[model samples]
Target: MGQMRLDTDPIVQVDRKPKCCFFFFSPKIQANRIVRAQLWVHLRPTEEATTVFLQISRLTPVTDGGRHIRIRSLKIDVNAGATSWQSIDVKQVLAVWLRQPETNWGIEINAFDAKGNDLAVTSVEAGEDGLLPFMEVKISEGPKRIRRDSGLDCDENSSESRCCRYPLTVDFEDFGWDWIIAPKRYKANYCSGECDFMHLQKYPHTHLVNKANPRGTAGPCCTPTKMSPINMLYFNGKEQIIYGKIPSMVVDRCGCS
Candidate 1:
């Protein structure tokens, strides 16, 4: 998804203003994906020049009804003695945090002076009114994965011959893939169109085009199903590779007789 503004107008600011939604898994992000969360804050120097630490911390809900504990924090160091609006990448500090669904997020800051006297920054409630602060979040989907030397993944190139694909398999949902196709001989294995379910007939074994033009390059060999070069469609609606046309059949009703 595109960048989105979370809490805007009610720009809550305080010596300790923490966004609560961040404490938990973000609804914007999906599982196993990468996302960036940002905070836009307008701050002014409440004390002498000092180092400000912007900490991204979280609280986890105890499963055993125990006390909630604080996890390691992601911190961003900044010099904020001067008044200015800064956009901070909370994700840069808290990268890899999206992997967990257990923690809730909040933002906290601490000001440290060279003399060791800790100071506090302007709170959201100060109502000084230079500008309110807000947070923005961006979520993105990750790329598809390819597994090799596994039970299922193979050396099959994608239908577009652009990338390698998983190999052919007989066991629809149970068994693993049989073998991988050679990368050198990679070929496009696009399926045919949608099956003509309304024309559910017996196993025609009708390679009409192939029979008409045996030597031509336009025939059954052109359409390959999830299994092999010969596409298959089933009478009982268990058809495969229905690519917007008549699908193949596999009921064993007539064994090519």
Candidate 2:
């Protein structure tokens, strides 16, 4: 059995706006010796109706290898006036444990209101050397919209407005990774006949119009159509590009599922 070192101790806090806490580990311990790991979170209730939510996963470098670290076990608990800290165990068998490449490890914890509105988020990392390093990520209050140029206008006589377009871009820096758009239309939306939603279907493509909704379908009045392809370039310690059709037709959705 290998030794486990905790870089940060568990603590509790209360916030009106809701924020997640973080703990970080140092990279001084042996990597291969670690057979399994676990995290214990102590949630101290500040209000009568307070509730807490949590999530744990591994974070790998983009350039290292396209491998996902398997978490053997995950536990969740909700308690009223609970004094003890909740324990989350992450363990794996030999083949499952060794399948993942040796890299930095990270876990993400989230809390939400009764209505499912995000209240807080916390993150912790375990380095290859067995040192646990942590960083806290604060969630924004609401949805954010980003725009970029989509060059697909055919009206050369309609002034510069005919040639200018805007596309959306999202940055996942809070998760310690970054990706960019690629030319592909894995999803689709309804728009004027002149708008070429299909052009964005291929790689190295861009949006054609600014007002055009990439999610617009031609059927119902407000039904969500398909979406454009988004090239994801992951930036861990190095740059890794994933060029493929998104599994689903939704936009801005994350996670392997």
Best by TM-score: 1
lDDT of 1 by residue, 1-257 (tens): 23344443332232334333233444656543436565555445545555554333333333433232333232334454555444556664344455544433344433334544433332444445324444555556455354442112224343432112333334432333222111112223223232232212322354444356658533222133233132221112221112112224221111111
Model 1 quality (TM-score): 0.34
Off by over 4 Å in 1: 8-28, 31-35, 61-81, 86-88, 92-102, 105-107, 111-123, 128-133, 141-257
Question: Best candidate per lDDT, number?
Answer: 1
Mind giving the per-residue lDDT tens digits that candidate 2 earns over 1-257?
11222434333232222223223443432334444454544333433355555455443444544234444333334555443334455433222333533433333444443546433223333332211222211111233354232223223244432112222333344444324322212222222222233434431223323336667433212112333343232213322122244443333221110
Per-candidate total of colliding backbone pairs: 22, 25
Worst 10 residues of 1 by lDDT: 248-257
| Lowest summed lDDT window (length 10), candidate 2 | 130-139
